[model samples]
Target chain A: MDLQVAIDRVTLDKAIDLAKQLDTQVDVIEFGTSLIKDYGLEQIHAQLPKLQHAKLLLDLKTIDEGEYEFDKGFATGDILTAMGAASADTLTKVYALSQSRGKQLFIDMMEITADKTAQIVNHPAAIYGIHHAKDSKAGFDAAATVAAFHEDYPMVQHISVAGGIDLTMAQKLATQGIAESVIVGSAIVKTADPVAAAQKFMEVMHK
Target chain B: MDLQVAIDRVTLDKAIDLAKQLDTQVDVIEFGTSLIKDYGLEQIHAQLPKLQHAKLLLDLKTIDEGEYEFDKGFATGDILTAMGAASADTLTKVYALSQSRGKQLFIDMMEITADKTAQIVNHPAAIYGIHHAKDSKAGFDAAATVAAFHEDYPMVQHISVAGGIDLTMAQKLATQGIAESVIVGSAIVKTADPVAAAQKFMEVMHK
Candidate 1:
């Protein structure tokens, strides 16, 4: 499993610094939704060149106006996300745009039911992100969730799981060999040493 | 009924200029999702002082991490929006935050089922936004949709409707007396004379 270190709720400068430091250690570097809404895409685009090694994923969390957000988002990042709850038309348009541009679309399956997920899972090129809402009081079992998701939708190839991921969970998910990537947010970015935290997660995943 | 003129897909300068001109004419001035993503909130916050009249609504369309997005959004906007499709915990956090600050939260009800709406529509102070996805090719009858929504969820006190609202549709919605506000986007902003177009819609709604 690839380690996708998410940078969130920090100043853009700090986020950039962390991204640069963690680029070589992780497979993908994510600028969370907080950075996008707090800082804006134009400014984020200007500062995107700071990272040289890792792929950049901007959590746009686009629900509507898919073409417009994707068009602007692709200018900076390698991957952009759209909410799975968005209408089929929105998903279809964004998926087409991402494919045409040779970029990737990550479909955020947050707060969506299995019935809805079945309708939108046909996009083979898009990454189906199994996101746990940050505000949920319930505990998340990342490995179990991925296993269930994989069982439910055997056709889904590119699966990414996120929310409250720790080193143990990362290793478990790696062993399961189902998820394409695991997204770590505060576990890496909020620690005293983000680079070290990321390397630790990377080491566990690879081992 | 209140009229909300949405400023979208325009340069920040033009949006500010239009907001300044329409501030006195409309009940609310909205910085659409496009503007927020394009310019960033800090930059938009810097320019928000120009509006001398009308409440500002930032369409944050927040799907997760409610508290963080709401805290930042409420800095400049009188009202901020969260996706109705968001987890109950997220909606709850944002709703409480908006209430604590005495700001308003608009829940964007896009692509959500009536069952889900039943779960999240208890916040009386929160405006339940009846939105049509921009990507959908289906025709939208704003007045009819609002009437049906009101009938289905009679407990939902505050209702706001958007999507291709024209002069006739605005007049119909105003007469229907179900919606608290009507949101107009390209119809008003894309016209050659945005100010005059806004005035015309205002006149129709009042009449």
Candidate 2:
């Protein structure tokens, strides 16, 4: 029942301020893909040094050039995510690289068909992330989505869920006890008091 | 055939210098994905203005948030690329956006399967880029690869190829008459005289 707060679509200074504020409070602090593409990985890496408690996950969403992106991502943070819809070869190679480096890989299961998921369920150590695209117009019951994913791929031990998640929904997920991490982006980061909002989420998640 | 000189893995100053030298010489001056990630797109756009003769193609390799990435990419240049391995929905949205903006789309068919290729060949206006991963341990034969891709998807009109393409392979691909553009990266950019290397490639590709 860990909380991952994602900061995105903001200026580099604001993103750094938020990262510094929430570093020791949250279980994982994600510098969202927009931040990475907007500010570049090197800039983020230079601004945010080694974390004291929380893991730093850079949402790279790499679809190709796994080795180069993974190497660069690992230099800055502890975990990186790749699209599940990428070629199985690329996914497998990235997983091997992550395992070898003693880092973690979060497989973003966004827009992937069931068949594609079946093809890539062999990576035991990798975290299978169930996500609904922010732009997706379709309705998603996050808890139900996680349940279905766990049933479909029982072998995947670690799972993460994200997309439009609020504190109540996060508590529901935590009570379900299947998802290893609950990712809340705008719901927590966009509030007037992000730190207080994050604390509220932590309270509900641990209750 | 057109020569798209990809300037990658070089410092921004060096890339700007080379682009200035080859601005009017090549058919397309590509700011590669490495440069895009090394420096933000805004900086890249500000640093490298439009080419005098050639179109500027920024290889965003966008896999998700198609609208946001395309909006940002097309703001800076006339052409952008999306991963063919991306969902058909993403590709379609990006293609429509590019068409509306009077720009171009280059679909990077790097690690996609044949079935996926068939599903994505409907975008006639998009250039189907045949690229081999630089980090691939297996050998790459660019000209031969284009011949096979053309045979498989004969309906795809605009074809582009990039790998470790040399002057000889560029000439061979030119004679083959399948690919509309040949992308050469390190072979030209890393050379002592990048403009001279580009001129040699243009010569070989024309003949």
Candidate 3:
């Protein structure tokens, strides 16, 4: 299992500082959707230093104009995200673009129905991200959610789970052995010591 | 009927220039999603001169984190957009914020299922924007799409239509007496004279 740290809703300077600090501590460093919308890709690309290790993912959450967004997004990061709720044509365009460019596209399966998910699950190279909306007053059991998702669509090889993940849930998910990566946001980024928090998560997940 | 000119895929300088030129000519000046992602909201807020006549709409296309996105988006523009495909919780949060703040929230109905549309059509104050994905290869008839949408959701009073809206389609939609506004992109922004193109659209719609 891999740990993906999501840094969100912070100053670009702070986000860059965190990314630099945790570069080798995690498998992936995600500049969350808020950061992208707040700082813009051009500015982020200009400011963020090259990571010596770990892939960079921008949570673009693109719902349309896949080609244009993906083209611009790939110029900055290794992985970009698109909404699973987007039309089949849009998903196919981004997926193909990601493959051709040797980049990665993560399909955010947020607020999508099973029928819709079934339609888009054919992209083997794409990562399917599962999570409840952050604003929703809903409870999320990450391990159970991943287990159910795996049962529903066993063909989806790469799966990433996010939403309020802590160390215990990370270890549970790691033991369950379904999700390829786990995304932790406030748990790692908002702590008193984000680097140490991230290290703790890494230790538990790899234990 | 209103003419909302969509400015997309251009340099910040060019976009600001276009907005300044078209501010008085159109009812609404839209900074498209591409611009928002290319240049962050803080930069846009710092640079964009306040519109003297027209309202400004930022196509945030927000799918989640509704409160945070809307809070930031409303600081920069009169109208902010949220994806109709977003969860009911997300939509409700943005709609409430928009109403409380005395601004407008446009629910983008791109590629949303009819069932989902039915669920979200109750927000009377919200502008329901109907359009196909710009990346989709499928055919789009703007006027017809609006007509069908209006017939199905009579409760939704404010409607905006986009996607390949030209002078003829704008006139047709205006005459059809359904959509409250028609959004035109390349037809207006890509022309040799954008102000004249926007004037032509305004002429046809208001004729």
Clashing pairs in 1: A40-B40
- What tier of docking accuracy does candidate 1 attain? high
Off by over 4 Å in 3: A132-140, B132-140
**lDDT tens digits, residues B1-207, model 3?**
999999999998999999999999999999999998998888899999999999999999999899999999998899999999999989999999999999999999887888998899889899999883344545557766777788888899999988887788889889999899988889989999999999999999888
Off by over 4 Å in 1: A132-140, B132-140
Considering only N, C-alpha and C atoms within 3 Å, which residue pairs clash in candidate 3?
none
Error of 2 at B161 (Å): 1.3
Which candidate order results from sorting by DockQ in descending order? 1, 3, 2
Interface root mean square deviation per prediction: 0.6, 1.9, 0.6
- Which candidate should be chosen as best, given TM-score against the real structure? 3
Model 2 ranges off by over 4 Å: A113-115, A133-140, B132-141
Give the alpha carbon lDDT tens digit for every residue of A62-139 in model 2.
Answer: 887788889888998798999897889889999999999999999998766778889999999998888844444455
Superposed on all Cα atoms, the candidates' RMSDs to the truth, in angstroms, are 2.6, 3.1, 2.5
In order of appearance, the predictions have TM-scores of 0.95, 0.90, 0.96
Q: Write the per-residue lDDT of candidate 1 for residues B2-97, one digit (tens) a residue.
A: 999999999999998889889999999999999999888999998767567799999999988899888998889999999999998899999999
Structure candidate 2, residue pairs in collision: none
Ranking according to TM-score, highest score first: 3, 1, 2
